[model samples]
Target: MMSYQKFARDVGFIGIVQILTSLSSFFLLPIITKTLGAYDYGLWAQINITVSLISSLALMGLSMSFVRFLSSETDQNKIQEAVYSILFFVTVSGFLASFILYIFAEPLATFGFKDPEATYFVQAGSLLILVSVVESISLFYFRIFRQIEKYSYFTFFETFGKLLIILILLKMGYGLIGVIAATLIVQGIIFLITLIIIISQIGFIIPRFTYIREYLQFSLPLTPNSLIRWVTESSDRYMVTYFLGLGSVGVYSAACSVGNLIQFFVSPLQLILFPELSKLFDHNKMDEVRIYMSHSLRYFLIIAIPAVFGLSALAKPLLSVLTTQDFISGWFVIPIIALAGLMAGIFQIFVNTMFLIKETKPATYINIVAAVTNVLLNLILIPIPSIGILGAAFSTLVSYCLMAAFCVHISLKHFKLDFYYLDIAKSILSSMAMYFFVSSFTISGILELFEAAGVGTIVYLIAMFLIGGFTDHEVSLMKKYLFRSKVNPSTK
Candidate 1:
């Protein structure tokens, strides 16, 4: 088993890379929205969401299963074989996905957009599924190999490539098509590059049919659950597009853009937690697993609670400066959705624990129920102009809240573990104190953001310190990590 400190460092490395990418996106969004306008932005968003749905299927739950199973394998030779086999599975899935999209490209395109030109965007976006599948597989492999530095390298390259392409094309007056085209081009390039690097690192070999079967045995059962999760996760954009039209969808998508920035912090937590928790489960260390769960929940809520409240409070000024006036309508949705992200992030840590214990059935069941509820709520609420994008945001809130509660109930019943409510309450109280501190600043735009964030950080630190959120021993460990010299800066 890896040391908690080392595991944290690895997760932090990935988190920093992800945060950089997210920052780039946040900075670029206003430029993209202004250049494309509402209708074009909406179209691009709809196409992307549609492509996301397909890519979820293209992934077919194999990536998560790959991480879990690959981490569990002990033998070097067998691990190599398993990696090659999973690679083969993903390649085949990608091809199958691309072909299906090609066959139904026209129907899928026109069904949502009702324009023939939109077909081209759909076709282009469909290819991104294959690219993303390949890229996810490569990244998971990198994680298993402990190639932390290379993982960061690929992450930045992927984000940078997409950013550069979008900026150049948007400047060239390509509009929404430019956005979709840029995604396709950049993802393709990154996928190829990562594949080449991985092949070089491992020396690729073609696996036999039995190797494929071994992977599928573990991977295939998880697909329905993955599909259900994708639906629940991406349903908001699709629901808005279907019920509210392209323009409304764009507005909600803009709101979600800000919300997704929170994921830069959450994703690395999930990545680290999933494998780490799986290891604990494999060893039957329920006590350590509970401690990790409590710690993860506390840490994430501390970061996210203020983030949601502060960002929402400052959304108007931030959007005005970062994006055009057109995007200001999304301002109202930010706080609501940001709060949703806070709840969802806490939920994700606990939900992932179910996977560790192989209690996936309940997770799948409740998510399906949640997904259905979201679609129904969108259909009922979107036509009311007063609700508008807020309705879409609320649908997500309701769905995830329901799913989170269900997951917690199931985990308790099946595993006899507790989520440590005292820890959660302390984090929440600290975060709320921090939020109020940050929101008290009387300013607007970027300056307001910096000032508020600065005050909030100091206040959060003081509050955590006063509240005894960290043990003295934990603080000493943190000091050692920060001050000690090391050959690899990441390891420190």
Candidate 2:
């Protein structure tokens, strides 16, 4: 019985949490960049990419399946069945993966970093895979249950705590090792905290193996999708590191991080939208599902379009202030990566259509195509002296565009959203307007960047309003949600 207003409010709250999380990371980037320098930072990036790749593989997509299966279930026993089943499987897989990574640490370091000295970091990073799986599944439980406030608290604490620990370790002269250790310690701590909270809420249960086969059937198809997504999103860093150098990887990663700010805008919607849509689709509420899908895309574009534009226009100054001159070349890659982020966001929306219908094979197929395309293009382009990291950035943008187009086409056969072409056009035009105004300013430092951003945002909003980017009804709805008292719907 979640009302539209309540949903909006939840999205807003989660959006704030996302903003804080992004900001915390944003703030930490400079510290790490300045402290570790490009080569070490690049190594750190590769380590993280490895962690994500292995962790995703080990989870076998069970985290997503948990949300899919458990979100609408009322049977407490069945809920426990889903929860404990996923936890047990993921825990065993996680530790096994961690052990393998630890045992193969040297070769992995040599392969990924071209430096055997990185073996210690690789061994330390192996621990992250185990703890992170638990953390992820626990958070997924919070999300499926719609305990957004508790979710937000844990998310913020983990993010902020990691930053604080990393900073202190760096100050203590732990250097690159400090960063890796911080990640492991912080994730392990948060994993324990979240585990306690979940157990307290749901109590403990020895999971029956009854649902294991069913869960595996639902989740197994998505394993390739997860791996391929890793390739699309992260394998490029490995390529960059291999082709150019860790310094180049570091520079590319900086731009990618900045561009990833687009996620803060879209991810909150994606997070809330999936479970909501799953429940709606489960109940045969196709009309509501369609409305949610259409509005989700439109609303995402309304913010993301301008963000991509503004960030692209201000990339030079922003990078100059945030990172050292060594990483400033990365500014060139920001616009391409930012647009890729937008495409990634759209891809998430379309893929939800696949998730809702339980036809996940298409998602795996689409990702395979995109991931292969990205790898081939990166190999072909990154070696060309003229392209280098720009090739990686362009490869990302092209692959995501391909994925989005393919997903949209496939999703239409099952459930076609209005696509909202005109509204999207408005968003693009408004963003362009914002870009022109923002780029006109001569920016040198943080203050000027802030000033230009403020002025650009104001101009974008005024232009959007004049160009009918938002309807009166939509604006009224926003006002009602933001200014009015909370509207509590009857429990579902």
Candidate 3:
């Protein structure tokens, strides 16, 4: 049995790793935006959206298949074959996907981005798709077997390495091309390192492709689900680009980026939650699943609720500090997008039930509704001169809310778990207090922003403690973690 204390500790450690990874992006934001200005920054954002879309398509959802199919496998030969099979398959598919993107770059640049000169950038960015596909597969090997430290360290190293390299390239005046090229180069370097480690541990074997059929059968339906999810999450940028142009989309993307930090609160939980849940479910451990889900949801809400509040409270100042004056106009969208991020996180936690049970259709239907709702809303709302880019943020919020509601309702039918409404209420109250306290700060720059953020975090933790928001078990577990005690998780 995997004790709750161990699980919580892993989540906590991954949370710290996520914070550091996010900080790299935080630092990169100013470097890229300040150097490229709004128009070119918007172009870079567009390139990223394209990469995310195509990469998902190319992988064909095999990443999730790996988690579902191989999370509990112990045989070295079995793991080796499954790992290499997926890697080789995606290598071909990833390359083909990259080639297609390279071929279509001209038309995509002219129509989708409305910048013919962006053709070269789009072509260069195609490599990011190939790297993303294979690296994700390589990294998922660590995740499936619960090797959290290696996973976290590699993620952090890749993120900061990209930041440092990209900053240098941009300083050398390489511009948007430098940003994309630096990312590709860093990801390639990291992938090679990861591959070497994987081979050394498992020993090389030419995959016979024995498991590919079963993996694809289970994973293929997830492809459209991913597509629809992307529509809900990212298609808005395309719409915003079409109606408002690159500068407006750039401002919107900047605000969306800040607001989207709320989602990071859940990444740690999501990263560790699904695989753990899969293993427990496979072993017929229903009670463990419930306990894990309940605790995971509670942890996610407590952290994420405060984050949405803090980001909303600090939106304008945060944006102003991280971006130039040109990007400040979209500050209002930050709170909206932050709330959307919270909804997305909720959807992520609950939707795991669908994945665990192999009920992909319900998840697919839910995303379809969200994607349609998002598209219709964006089409109707964004073109209005008064609404403009705010419409995109609003669409994201509504779509995510719908997806969360639908997933939670369906998930409850499949299995009941503790929702802990009172704890959530306590969390919201604590977040509100943090919001008021943080709002009182007069932030003027990055240093002031970090100071306010630090103090705001302290205030929130203090308020939660004063209200007895944390359970005794949680308190003891943290004590063990902080004091570096050798915790027997079961005893705790």
Q: Pick the candidate with the highest lDDT.
A: 3
Q: Tens digit of lDDT per residue, candidate 2, span 348-392? A: 998998889888888988999999999999999999999999999
Please count the clashing residue pairs in each candidate, in the order shown. Answer: 0, 0, 0
Winning model by TM-score: 3
TM-scores vs. true structure, each candidate? 0.91, 0.95, 0.97
TM-score (C-alpha, index-matched) for candidate 1: 0.91
Error of 3 at 260 (Å): 0.7
The lDDT values for all models are 0.74, 0.88, 0.91
lDDT (10s digit) by residue, model 3, range 323-429: 99999999999999999999999999999999999989999999999999999999999999999998999999999999999999999997898989988999999
Q: How far out, in Å, is residue 115 in model 1?
A: 3.5
What does the lDDT read for residue 11 in candidate 1? 75
lDDT of 2: 0.88
Can you list the residue pairs that collide in candidate 1? none
Better-scoring candidate (lDDT), 2 or 3:
3
